[model samples]
Target: MKGRKFSPQKKDRRKAIRSIVEGIVLLTILIVIIRALLPSRGYFPVSEDRNLQTEQGFIAVSYFGVDRTGNKTLISTKRLEEHLKALTASGYVTISQQDIINYYTAGRPLPKKALFLIFEDGRRDTGIFAQKIMEKYNMKATILTYAQNLTLEDSKFLKAKDLKELEKSTFWEFGTNGYRLSYINVFDRHDNFLNQLNTYKFQLVSGYLDRNYNHYLMDYIRDASGIPMETYSQMQERIGWDYNSIEDIYKRELGKVPDMYILMHSNTGQFGSNDKVSAENFKWMQKLFQMNFNREGDSLNTSQASIYDLTRMQPQSYWYTNHLLMRIQDDTGEEVAFVTGDEDRNNSWDTLKGQPEFIKDTIALTSLPGESGLIKLKKNITDSNIEVSVELDGNKAGIQTIYVRADDELEEYLALSIENNVLYVYEKHKGGEKKTIFSLNLELHDGIKPQSLEENKLEAEIKELETELKYVSDVELTKRLNEQLKEKKARRAASVIEGAKEYIPEIGISEAGKRFLKVMLENDEISVIIDNKAVTERLKVSVTEGKGVYLEAAPSKEGYSQRNLTDDVYDGVFKSLVISRYSTEKKDDILYDNRLAGFEKVADTIQKGWDSLINWFIKYL
Candidate 1:
């Protein structure tokens, strides 16, 4: 039987079905392949819950003590003893800086109450005193020193020897405050910035390596010669000594670290050559610490009891010498507490007392032990009642209080809450008396409640990706490579022109020929155009400008000679003929000629002509 002719529509439908089937098969295979390659959902198990409990407490004693002259200093022996007595009496545990650093770095919890003692400037007296007191109290202190002062003779300053001794002690560690105290001044100068930087490096390395090694060793010791002898030094050099830089430097030096850091600053007594506390310098220091500790103000409270408690990790929360108002709300999002700095002693609380609606409904506490100044309020409501909310007028700087009561009987229903913000008091009545006796809202403030590394292989993968991205996206780098290519081409063009220049004079050429040749030889822009353009009818010549040379070329109307001209004229001809005397030094012909050898001799000559023509074209183009 003869095969039946299929209709066009039927054929098209069959083809479409085939395509769809093939697409479906391909898609299915792709899906399977993707599923096989994709990471499994359960590949990584949940990490064990990290202990996020933050024990909030103040550093009881000031990290730096004030001296007799009102200058900040390390705690004197007498003061240290008194502070320690108070700290211990308050049941606080004193830990060293090393302990803190180690515990924090290891991700271990700190003691309930802990304080860190940090001495700046590396004074001999402070160093000696710190060592003795730390030894006595079994505590730790960090000493920040200017490396330049670490000479052997300057025993009055904590020298290299003292650092060595301190390093051996479990209670102390050393940090750099710069090579000299001149980091600030030197950094500010514009003209000698680079020189001062070099000096800083020399000083830093010299302080570290100078005593042990002589000039010979210093010159050859690559690591020991620069201002950036240490990783921290290099970081500081790059990023400067801003607060972020300091924190980053600390981490680089100490490894994975916590928020606490030992910093140095000038004391009042030892204000160096500068007479007054440099507000700028102090601001820098304050910013640095505030950023690191996440504290609010510069006024550091130095209560020995609080310090001991903070150091030991006791009393989970305590106020900083400076306080901040935080917003508080009940489950229902009602405004219950609103405190302002100005209202701490009067005003806001008194206003609440005068409000008849609040006063009649709330009980005024006359003689509630430890609850006198605070106002108390209470009311009977269902389980779904809105909780109190506390709002602050401004950033609250100090503490405030609140009190709540349930019944009319003064003794029956009483709840007290203290906060800088509004306090939500949840209460339940005991018996069926159902007498709404005492209900008072108290404006009071008390603080309470302690509320709560890296895999190298994974890191390597991330770093590799970053490097690849850098290579792909760097425009400047690509431009630089292109520039190098251009330079090489220019040198090659120059070589061909030099050789052709000698031949041109022998060929009985005209004065115009020499002039054209000279101008091409000098212009860089002429050289680039000569190398880039193609020879064609009308000899569509494009010229640009560079160096001091100008290009002028007369086009030959005769096609045959023009063809011959085309063979001799490439980019090199214009590049070599133009005489550019723009550079201070004379152009080196021999070097250019040698590079031109890389290209065909004929092509090279043509390039020079093209270069010259382009130079002239540029003047007109």
Candidate 2:
């Protein structure tokens, strides 16, 4: 066969491409090796004279975990960095377990603004995502582990080897989340008794297990009838076995058990859910460790705290840095510093009411109890046809609103509100009648389909009932649970509702992520999209001219908390507000409110194939 001939230009191009690939590969390998050998303690500097006296005590804050892409509870590395930067700027220094013990037991002085940071769950991703951030901030954090996880070969959780390396890195300290995370004395939402479940089983059936389940160490082992399955002596023996197992795992894996212990669950009565369990856990923890974090949700630990009894506030993934500062100030009862990010962005927003602080890349509009916080962009959208794009990052309990084409006083305007996972569009006329243009129930959003949602829920229920029925030797309970399983399994077939689901677009506007929202006002018609999905085609609007964009946030009717210093205070967080004039008649439809993801996916596939072809040459040539 004759060889295909290439022009001089094509041959030169090929040679250049090959040279670039080889250089990139060699550079990548070199960078990896250099990074491995580098000793990166931390970038945020700590002084040698570390003893600064203060009687105000220290704030202990913990996170569930960190991940590159976060989940419902785990925080993303981007958020963690912002929080650490804010804390560092506010003069908060990270304290170690030894530092905490010295402050509580030896009556030693801690830094005026000290923080005991912790990352729970001991997830491999948590260590991977948080490592660079910790190094960048020069911060120290304790990693809490499940002792049983050390024995498992699952790569989801960190192994003993990873922990040993982390210890060597000097950025991490180890602790225990008891022997494991399991639930006992469990009851489903339907009041179905599911006696006991391991962590894996609990995750497999968590949709059936709401807030009614108890920690394995919290309550006495209960049978299906909710009676104590084991006597007092037997209960103690069972719990002691957990403690012994934890000790044994630590000894086997890391030569000795760590001194830090965070209790398995929340208990207001000193340690466990109740007095008996609390006492048992307290005694065992004291016998095994030097310090125990006995509570969550409140961060302040004073000199009066027992060395064996400490507490840390677990920061939810939804929390802003201000929320943490607000909590710490309240718990410590001290005036604290806050992070005010991007003065230019802050200057652009004018507060109508309440405190509005520009934090990181978002404008944090925090409202006081019983009142609403409102802010408006200084610039007005004068064009009759305009588009507004923003991201709403607020809690489930608050009402966060984006107002477009509103009066300067906001008496008459168009409001798009996200209240308790529902989207509402309203037309307001001050002294006259207010009208609801349309309200959309945001039950299922982007990245989730209606069928997938129902299927997942049903699968969880079936799994729960099946697991329960498998172990239940009781005839009546087993029969009842089996019937429930059958009913759940029957629901696997997706049903069609003849209503407006077709009209409703899959908009991801839930509390899980920073929900992206874009609205278009063409004359008197309003078209809306949320989280890059088309939500509404066109809705009629009464008022539609002259006014600018306004952001308002307030505690929902059910969201108010009586506590003095809590993040329950609503922060109407907004970022990436882009308001511009739009002409539908003249311009081609450029908005990807419907199929942006599809376009990106196709483009990415082509780019990856081209790169793979280049890699083939790099390998075979």
Candidate 3:
């Protein structure tokens, strides 16, 4: 009828069990305390594998030409091929600027080793070289042009036809470095500046400057008196004028306007112009797209917007010969370095006083009339085939028979023959055995029809998002949403092409459009025609993910170094990354010591010990 009286031994056993339980509790608390004491990873996960691929910063390398011997900007063709071979072998994936922008804006994941390759100055040779190399490597590159170099009359520079051809490759996209800004006199005089602005804008509107000028607008902000003349608002007016001009030109020529403007030549807001104007100009440009710095510490927002400046790093010296790797430290403290190629060493252009010795010739290529140039194609039949004519300018060494084929159709035809400087691609009633040829002309506008009904819905949704984003209190969310909207708008803009993808007879054709097709077919080698599909398939495989980090660098030991990055330390770095070219200050201060510190090192050791103890106990039991 009562609780049994416990023996002294039983009482001791109860006490021991209680002691053991207390000890376990203390041990667990101690473990937690130790974990807390270890260095924090901040946003990064303890497991390295858990790190998002997007968190890692990537590199965009500018190229001029491969094997352009003696040209300062040229990387030897052999060296370039070797570099690509190494990059592919080391798991690097070539991506577009759109892909990079999308990743930050939309939280899109990128391949483990993303790279952006840009070719500057719009040289036809460079386009051709890029085509060959890009096809070989299944890589994509941004072909940045200057307005002065883009006339249909130019043979030295890439013309509209060349651009159209290059764009058809699926590996090339067109971006403008500057309009006639490169060719105009951006003097400190007000008249000069005004003239420069009007000229470039007029050039864009008048002719084949089809793409939006993505690079920064370089202007001489100071007056002839060597004083900063323009007030902040005046500077804004001038810069805004330039922006509006370019926008208008793009709208008139390409049927759409550009929301994004890359700062050209300098990183700081006041590069080539007054800092106030430069910063304000960038800010105004952002506002045009309904974006701005409404939040602090938001690197991806307009607060961090800057001119995307690239430099050779070494001035007066042939830096391109040395293999260089330019590293960027992102806001998240992850570091990424792109293999910028042989000329990027030491960022010579950053230190050079005068024009670099490598840039021997800065003259704009003479423009040739596109409509009346070397060749022309008339749309005899809508969207099916065109009549080709060649008006050779005394240089007609290679004259051969012409052939035509549709993209979706397999059958090829002996389209025409060349005599004197003329090409006869008219109807041939009587024909003999002829060669069959595949043409990119047929695929010129494939799938890229005018904005579809769905695009209209997307535009409406984007407008709604824009209104919501304008008043949204959460800055971060606003930015993400804003980026999504920008991306959507870009997609929609892309859909508003003047011509359809693949020959659509429904859309009326133009002589300029026909000529684009003719030039591409003429320029393409037989191998390129056959290998187009295979190259596209290979591009998919070229971007596969792999375990661990991959570092790509050249053999020059002087050009390579490591750096540690932190979130707070990387804000300026991020700004610098976006707008400015490479500088020694950035290399030494920003890019040095970019390693991420997290809980991984400490936690893993403890986890292993705990597991080992448990396993030992199980075995003994």
Candidate 4:
């Protein structure tokens, strides 16, 4: 049977429709191919800004890692974007290794605000998550890799091929952390000797290896007794071997090693914990690389800084954008435009004292060295029994208090204070009388059992003794340390909690991590839960009629270090604060929730997409 023939007009219409569909598909493919082939051209607003000065020196900032979802150490993509956007908006531009070298060596000028951005550890996740942001901002960064990962088949770390591809992307340049990351002469808090541990083994037993653990090159080759076994020349050779290996691997894999090198373990009196070993490491570093990040915390680098000894600040994942700015300004003595993550979220709260800024999904109630910052959630509720569920930054440095049933005058409230790993249940009213209803030292108190506390004390004692014994050269002090260590060891061995499995933290509250906080106020009684475990079964509180949720951050007298240092500010950040009155009125106030309602979110996303589409068509159509 002959196929039915369409009229010429009908065929033309069908052909035109088919051609349009083909054209769209081809256009999309062409755009993608062009994007892949195009070389990235970084936009330096700082250089373009004639009003800004370029005579000032550059500063380096390093991030440990980045991932889709952030952790205590690794930053999330969203936060990374915020950080980069803020820097770019403030007329800061990323500088390359050559740019820095030129600035120092040739007396060439830098941008008004030059940023030598870095992402250390050569993590695949860091590359995956951070690359888009770098591209988005037209920024460039040096991605540090471990030369040891070159030989290994591990996919967790970025391989040499990955590094080369990253270089091709123009957003990334290659650098080396070291040949390997290892520890030596290590005594854990439990007084267990961990001799020469690799990265995997080190992580497996990381909780124990706190202050006692030393960087592999930080000390001479030591025996189990923590005595240096290596001679001066032998120590030099051992240190040189790792550096040589790093050079060899990079040269073999990626043609030549990148110029930048971040020596592991900072805050060691300029370079290394061991002076002689540091001298050797410094010699090797200078010979191998043009620059070395010899220190962390201080990000500023000037012409006066030694090429072999540079510094950069590694921003922890917990840092608010303002916190980052505070640190940078403190370091460089330059005024920085402090960033408030999302100002629109502030409409729900009243800042009672100090500064309260919204930072992404959290509210940073930041305070100065000796100041207290407080903010109240603006919602009217009459329920006496209400629950405040929050995820706190939970720092050991400052006090993070959850005030429930707070009066409008801010005179009376039931406060659950988390300070220096201790939970203080107290009441505040208009009168001068301040009553402590309950107090539990979270460091001593365990969710499982209290026996673990004694065991921890013994281990901590042993750890202290070991540390003293290692540091003290005096015969008398060493003997005393040994005796104390022996007694602690005996106690630990005799303790019944030795074999018990526990996840007891070194510090109950961490400055770098988030802890779940839930406080339930019931008439005259209040209950507290931290990290989903009951902190107190029953905490008696004064009867409060009003249902006002408040947050406070005060300068901690204890817990974090450098207490004597003046002008030190602490920010107590809290995320996802929700107050629910379950029984009576069922009133719920998501005071600081950053998320929109489901339908609203859908509409927002559609609007954004539509705007983007329209803008793109307008630009290129």
* Winning model by lDDT: 2
Q: Relative to the true structure, how large is the alpha-carbon lDDT of every model?
A: 0.31, 0.74, 0.37, 0.73
How well does candidate 2 score on lDDT at residue 238?
91
What stretches of model 3 exceed 4 Å from their correct place?
1-52, 65-70, 182-220, 229-234, 257-261, 269-273, 287-322, 325-621
- State candidate 3's TM-score: 0.36
Question: TM-score winner among the candidates?
Answer: 2
lDDT of 2 at 552: 88
Tens digits of per-residue lDDT, candidate 3, 90-199, equal: 45567665665666567666666665566666776566544555666677777766544544466667766666667665767777654444322332111213122243
lDDT of 1 at 261: 30
Model 3: per-residue Cα lDDT at residue 74: 63
* Model 2 weakest lDDT span, ten residues long: 500-509
lDDT of 2 by residue, 441-510 (tens): 6766554444433444555567877766655788988888878777777764443352222222222222
> Which should have the higher TM-score, number 3 or number 4?
4
Error of 1 at 370 (Å): 21
Error of 2 at 9 (Å): 10
Task: Return the clash pairs for model 4, or none.
Answer: none
Q: At residue 226, give the lDDT of candidate 1.
A: 35
TM-score of each: 0.26, 0.77, 0.36, 0.72
